[model samples]
Target chain A: MNKMTRQFEGYSFIGLWIIGFMAFSLGPLLFSLIISFFKWSLLDKPVFIGLKNYIDMFKLDPLFWKSLKVTFTYAVVSVPLGLIVSLLLAILLNLKLKGMGIFRTLFYLPSVITGVAAAVLWMWVLQPDFGILNYFLSFLGIQGPDWLGDPNWALTSLIMMSVWGSGGGIVIFLAGLQNIPQLLYDVSSIDGATKFRQFRAITIPMITPSIFFNLIMGVIGAFRTFTQGYVMTNGGPLNSTYFYALYIYNKAFQDLQMGYAAALSWILFIIIAVLTLLVFKTSSSWVYYETERKG
Target chain B: MNIFGKSVTYAFLIISSFVFIIPFIWMVSTSLKEPGAIFAFPPQWIPDPFLFQNYKSAWTIAPFQQFLENTVTIVVLTTIGTVISSSIVAFGFARLVFRGRNVWFAILLASMMIPYEVTIIPLYVEFKLLGWIDTLRCLIVPSFFGAAFNIFLLRQYFLTIPYDLDEAAIIDGCSTFQVYWRIMLPIVAPALVTVAIFQVMNAWTDFMGPLIFLNDQRNYTLTLGLNLFRNSYLTEWNNLMAIASLVTVVPLIIFFIGQKYLIGGIAASGIKG
Candidate 1:
């Protein structure tokens, strides 16, 4: 009787959490999925319009395709660039040196100053006439483009800011680098392996898991790039920075096309799911796990 | 490494640090400059005659004090609620052998992938039905339920605590709730602090939540307040930068104070993932 009572007590503790999950998360998720099939606005009753929202998003919407392209381009360009830059920085920081922690913290600062503050700060930083970026460009004898204002450079400018803020990835990669056994590097050195050779052979393989993790996360994060667009550009300079999330936000809230926005979000969900699944499917070939190694 | 290699690394680190820190330095510089000096040719790194009044002007231009008060209330409530709820829920997952625990845990993990955009619409409708649309409750109450990432993070930390501690507590006639509160919670204080810091940062920097839900300027968090301030004062770059710098200082201070815990928490999540 005592054991049974304890079990019930334990179950009830988690039961509270389950109730919350259903009410806030799971229930809302199902509601959105259902509403994606209807024509609902806040002021009107939700009219059943099965599959039409999806159909319109695919067939009728040009901005949908444009936003999709913009988001994908961002993920593709930013993720790889962020990965390579962060990995290089991590490798540099991984060296046994005094005062590396200070540098690490400085590099990681940008990631912490997120949202509207960072966006506003960047607007000034990328200001064409009096901005620091153009000031530097002039010194190099190269004319700088109007960054956030020019349609040609708005998205590129966002990507630049993102790469600068890839400091979090560097920290993560540094942790992964620290986990790589020093013994392996020592053995490689003893066998006359050059730094580059050892890096290619051992370090790359060892840190593939971290790379993979950062890649997936980078993809997810990049696709949801909203604040910069919302705050800095408002998805403008001719909608060049109109990210999918920004588009969805405008659709649902501004235009009051909640059901259409729900459909767009579902499409985004599917794209992310497919992309993530593809990465996982391909990960087996490259991701090296020490515990999985067999003689 | 040799002297040449060391110099190369040092040079690279210095340049990279400059790139990372320049915006902040420039922001502070611009904030202190008079409007005439702000757009000066060959941009001023330092203001000749510091307009220290920019900070004062920035504060008065908008209801920033009220915004800060609003943000602090939300952050404090959410952080405390998240730490408590997530830790307790994580304890159940890490210690208890409840039925369907694995399935539920898997569901928790999977829910992390569902983007906020996917849920925001219905969540808005739900909050509207509850008449929570223009209130701080829309922001604070959902966090009390426990976030999936925080729960997962705490559960990972909880698993590291030896089961013998729980067994010892149970042997002493402690109920599971008592074990969680007395034995487990104290032991996992570091992880709890980490969760608190992350929650505080999230609640502090949250833009979309306030943007969507809070309709009144009086209830606006600092982020929404600052964004609206910028929209209204498009040409007042000096004041905007001043207020932006002021708003950003809180998170910077938090990062500096909890530097070790924040990095360790992030590293823990990354390595485990």
Candidate 2:
């Protein structure tokens, strides 16, 4: 047999065995779609409402809009800033300087920490009264805001808490940096390309794929962010930090609106799908393809 | 290289390092502090008198013994489930030729795009109907099936494994499953460790899953229990810091020690974002 046919023959078992995985992974997801279409109350039989849940959320619900606004604001402000920050750190970290490994590990340490720990720790730091943050500020003769308790600062505080342990992005960026061949740097240097130019031309283009990956994943990940919001703020300070996921969580578990929650899930699904498509659409301009496209 | 560039790198590195280390250093320091100085600033780097009593305080506040037990048990189960199921499914996707393979694989790939949070509501209702709330089953069941990400990882790694290895195993009269157990699994040790560590770390630090499913309090995992201690009050700073420190630091210490393994495994696995 030819290489293609042999490879095909080799992969033939996946056809049969994937059934078990498909059943479990896809079963609940399919069930979710059915639940999304109905007014499922668990206690009673679900009533089919078609797309009423979507309609209600778009035109009727008050909290949904607020949650959407808060979540979108977070995604926009944080993603690009985080990308730039982490990429800069990745470049510095990629340096051949001594003790850089220690620095790398120290930076990466934050990501391994549970979100709960960081959230709790920040609650103390952001505390306006008797907090170490405020105490330090008093030395400078300035007062600190009640970060978690203030409506305006609440979401921003949550964002700060989110970025506190953002080392995973750095790890990916570092790995991407490693993939850029040394020759690129060598040739650019021979041409007397300045350090800034080398970085702009060499570092940026080569890491475009990872940057695209991180951006898409970052947005998707941001939308699903719940731990800090659930732990630190509990969607409080007049619901300024009330994220979409948190709102869905409250609707399902707290208020027993399973149908509404499922509906919310589908809504989130649509949003993410559209967003993913948008990223891919825009990626043609920025994302570097390594291989020639058959098309 | 410009002197300015070098100094700027150092400047950024130093300040960023401080930002990273403060919470960790404070966590350890406060754990060793007396109750009176828990929040005192310049946040006394050295507690006036080192207290071993904080450990005792942290232990007594919750059924942490049960929390530890539950956390360990669930993590072990999930790790085993993820390893076995993911590898099995990955092999099928990786090695076998089956009908509608592209369609099924595409379905699995599509599942990766749908965020895990999207399924929580249906899962909750499904589990509630099955009366699995507060049970460890709720925690492990979802992961027991091959996750799309893991399956994708294993498939990618398996693709890299030479076809010659499987052919040689088959020539020795090995069944497909035996070839998998004897040849495939062994060769994929690095990938397995990578996945195992990922599972362990995720299970160790996961607060949201246990917080939602585990309602009995006795069934609380380390992360949830630590959250409870911290969230209890503004004044219970000593107990809060001590307990939170204990739980958060445990897995981190383990990861720190195995940092080489984690860094190596992550690089080797080449996991998709």
Candidate 3:
């Protein structure tokens, strides 16, 4: 410990920051918890209702199951597909060649686009009649499905959009690719390993850590998806794309069932948390942590 | 490494790149299209008689300028609050030897698990009580407290800065505040930038916050504006797309203009936990 010649005793920066943080966050955080217990809409004062709202959501919310189904369905389908595409894109962009920076920039550009904009752009493209998709389909004498307008295809349409704006994951994949030892690749080349074989042997094993990272993050992100549903379809032609977050949102905010929404939110959080823990537990078998060997 | 494999790689990259770029390219082209040709049976890559009136009309239908102002006001305040709040909190967790520091930090980490859904009910009621609903305060205030994720993310960077800086400053009769403000802050500038960029983008593009909190039409953000377009003009293809294009993509395009800074920011944040 050192003696201070003149301690600045007048102001407390830490206190100011805490005061600021709590001033803004505490009300919302605490208020939300308080409201989760009572049943109230914006019109009337919230009345104490105990666990009735919670019970009702779990037992009776019709759209609850449907929303869960749609969300998990999208998550299950999109996560692996996105992971592979990002990895493949990262591998290509990491090549020893000229103008790769341009390619990298191009691939990452779509991700930064707001989800609303992407939805709007794709809405035009995916419009069944008079849209570009059908026009292309007509050229091949194949008709395109009604994307958002069709109940059956709306969720899938959103899934396709999720895969498109995957620049964030692609960046992480590129970082993982860069961390690979060049000596391993060079040695494999000397052994006359085919590109596919080398990728299987060296690249895949080496990038397991990144794979685990993306897998966990992808699951969490997928579970929390509400933007596309809000933007593109409003959960759809017939609630086809209504995800868990959107469902809780509609129940609490739109429909004004506060307690029920809290219950729903808790359920979704638990499901996601469990899914994350599962991934973490499973990773021990496949994941290659860099420091584990030394320990 | 083989020549044939290299060609295959190039082909995959070129084709996939085209697929990814198509919607963005088409969005720009369609925004400029005349009313008659917005969704012409055959998709037109080039708009004939490129009408820029859609932009003007779109602006009128939805107050793009007003929405821009509202969004900017909210985003700027939130980012400033976030930078001021999160970095200091991160500093406390990174350097302080206070009782319950570990416990409080753990609580912060745990809060990250509690999604927006869990907190929406009480917040809505509280906002109503505080007279915050339909105001920019509702949008900006919740974020000022420093998100758990941001605190954790920045704390990771803060921990990696050499403690020698703090020790030397202490020897020079510097207080903890002086050590934080003068000695340690400069080294973590990139992480601060990263935090700033993330908060800016999140606040700027945020839909749910504005959607729930803002009831007044004038306060709607770009996200809420886009949703309004879908609801109101369900059929007016060209104008809506034009407005959506500018509102949604423009901020990101502008944000990334200094692209190297963002990359450097991420790398700086990457060195720690």
* Top model number, lDDT: 1
Q: Calculate DockQ per candidate and list them.
A: 0.68, 0.49, 0.46
* DockQ-derived CAPRI band for the predicted complex in model 1: medium
Each candidate's fnat: 0.63, 0.46, 0.43
**Global lDDT of each candidate:** 0.89, 0.78, 0.77
Q: Please identify model 3 stretches exceeding 4 Å from their true place.
A: A1-37, A45-49, A190-194, B264-273
Flag the better candidate by TM-score, 2 or 3.
Answer: 2
Score candidate 2 by TM-score against the native. 0.92
In the range A97-162, model 1's lDDT, one tens digit per residue, is: 888988998888888889999999999999999999999999999899999999999999999999
Output the TM-score of candidate 3: 0.91
Q: Over 4 Å off in model 1, which ranges? A: A1-7, B270-273
Clashing pairs in 1: none
List model 3 lDDT by residue over B77-186, tens digit each. Answer: 98888887788778888876655567667766666666666566667677788999899998787666676777777788888887887889889999888888887778
TM-score winner between 1 and 2, please give it.
Answer: 1
- Shift in Å, residue B91, candidate 3: 1.6
Model 3 whole-model lDDT (C-alpha atoms): 0.77
Query: What is the number of residue pairs that collide in model 1?
Result: 0
